[model samples]
Target: MGCGACMTTPRKKGGERREEFIYHRMDPTDVHAVARKHARGHYCLCPIHGPDDDADLIRDTYKDLGYRLNHTEFFMIRSLSRIPRVVSPVTLKRVTTIKMAERLAKTAARRQILPEHVDAEDPPMRVYVALVKDDIVGWVNSVVADKATYCGGMYVQPECRRQGIARALLAKMLRDDRKGGARQASLLASHAGAKLYPVVGYSEVGTMMVLTPKKK
Candidate 1:
């Protein structure tokens, strides 16, 4: 498991150029060596609720990399019942169509989902697509273990952002989970997804920090 630690920012508030750090999770065993070859642009940091108070591991890991934890984010949990149904042109589809798979392949590089795995007759994971007037607009995937629904592969098209598609998909997700007899649902929310989850019944349950290379 990785942890967070931060360095001291310069006290000068005026005209001081602020440095930004992006977090990445990898084989933490050799971070200083591998990170240089495999870095990507940034995205939102997911919030965790209450984090472990022990800073020893986080402190020690970054100390070796010459970086420090800047801030800790809270991740959340919520009851499915807390999500209210939303009405929109977006209708949730249970299967991933050919276009859906291709669209995901082109834009979902960060998602790390295998193309073959997306359309198994009885996939080990459950997948759902969102449609806007017959065009695939978004999609999500989840797996149920220990009576909890762990979500992933949540994505919406760029052209369709801020139009309530993600929330509508989430609403369908929770609704279907309840019908499937699940008691609760959980997901690792990105900074972008955090805005939608809290509105449902999820609350901060833990914390995680991102690590990126320091500027040269």
Candidate 2:
């Protein structure tokens, strides 16, 4: 398969900047060249997705280039109609302003929010924040394409997790998407999310490895 990549420069927790090359369904033979080309003069992260059998080879190739495995995410999907509806105990509101998006990003430890995320006339993404009184406790977003919705950035505060905030957020998002005519929903889930998503009708369809350049 041909390689496809999207580049992003996101700041780490301590204000460190890193460039990421997120590759989707890349061919094994192209891994080394693509990574080396983009890794020059900056800290680089390569999250690669490919055939399951090539996973080990891809990891070894990256290791030789001073990249280490940071994490693995499961690619999951489910029919929107199958997602169970859940009621959030807290309030859920659409994020329609830069201020609201910024707060959600900071609270969720996510990347910076941009205008496209909260555009009034034509927003590319739909974000929902969970509110317990006035405090934003959790958030999720969805991007719809070709009758399918890609759900992501789901997060809840550490103290608020076990109270079903995630499930409620997911259900609300998927329910809205289904009503909007999206038949399928998909997301890349972390280990913790992998366990939770199944409860809302998601099934793992594939896996991807996230790698970062080894620090000196």
Candidate 3:
């Protein structure tokens, strides 16, 4: 039996506040009951990841309940033993303060910085920022668990890309993870990221599908 998980976020739609339920790795048998219980008067999204046949069955089940494909991503992973030692032209700094996280959130247009961004708890999380002349231009973060690091929230300003900032940030994060005892890194790569991560040593392991209710 696959274990199901959900995350809820509040959003504003047409001047009205609503919630969105995002389900991850949910069991197929539990989908309808859970969706009915939590998705009333709200948006719901299910991101399925696994073997093709299993994912297809879950997708078909959602389709029968009026859901449609929202997007797809590649599930990529790489061993951390051989991260390239790319030198960043821009300065890189580890974010360890709420003040710094707030600045990153503002520059990245993120909703807000949470306590966990700087919390020193187990399953360690780390955020790194790229700076040019004291201004943040790119950032990336990772969370380590069970000897693997999951990387996400990677972004580089439009004007600052193609100059190796993204590569630098990734290299720095992966190297740090390796030093910290993580043996591998994983991420769900968007279309654009699918192109970039391969250059950094990640290999596609599977496809992930994001499904949402069809507009009526």
Candidate 4:
């Protein structure tokens, strides 16, 4: 917290005033503490109390967390994304209509969606799809929370398997989410997703499981 007193202020909907002091570019060299707070944790908007994308700030944040920023200004351990070739042109589209969800739901009801756990919905969720020549090749569902983004479902059509469509959809989804404002993205990687996340710049920081009771 050294450099100086920095505050983040965001205009309220009613044009009111609000302020917060989280972290700042000049905050001190012991950034590890700041990084620790953000380690496997929700990212706070820049601490300088303003809107800015500073490479120096990103570098310092990682440095504070004991993560080295390489010559390219990305985490030393992770590779900056290399845009993968699509192999074939597949249209990626956001499922703006509820119809798509309904479509997925119907497919789920028939157990066509790899995992049967995808059918239930509380308030329903947004869906994204990758289509080829009008055929549904892949789909993903996500819900956002204060701390993280939760991916509920990701399934590639059986016939489209092994064509790299799933990976393309995943990469597109993660990039879209990050662009939309996510400090970090996470998902309950299925058996297949566990293998894919790392390829797209996501590292395994934890594990997840489902608990259920058995009926005697």
TM-score of each: 0.60, 0.81, 0.82, 0.49
Clash totals in order: 18, 0, 0, 6
Each model's lDDT: 0.59, 0.76, 0.77, 0.49
Better of 3 and 4 by TM-score: 3
- Name the regions of candidate 1 deviating beyond 4 angstroms: 1-57, 60-73, 96-103, 106-123, 211-216
Off by over 4 Å in 2: 13-16, 39-54, 105-112, 119-121
Pairs in steric clash, model 3:
none
Instruction: Report the lDDT tens digits of candidate 1 across residue range 167-195.
Output: 77777777867666677887766676677
State the TM-score for model 3.
0.82
Off by over 4 Å in 4: 1-88, 110-125
| Highest TM-score model number | 3
C-alpha RMSD (angstroms) for model 4: 15.0
lDDT, candidate 4, residue 68? 45
Minimal lDDT window, size 10, model 2: 43-52
lDDT of 3 by residue, 96-141 (tens): 7888888987787663335675856553688899999999988998
Error of 4 at 74 (Å): 25
Q: Write the per-residue lDDT of candidate 4 for residues 3-96, one digit (tens) a residue.
A: 4222323343456433322343444334334444433422222233222355565555545544442222011112223434444358887665
Residue 12 of model 1 has an lDDT of 43
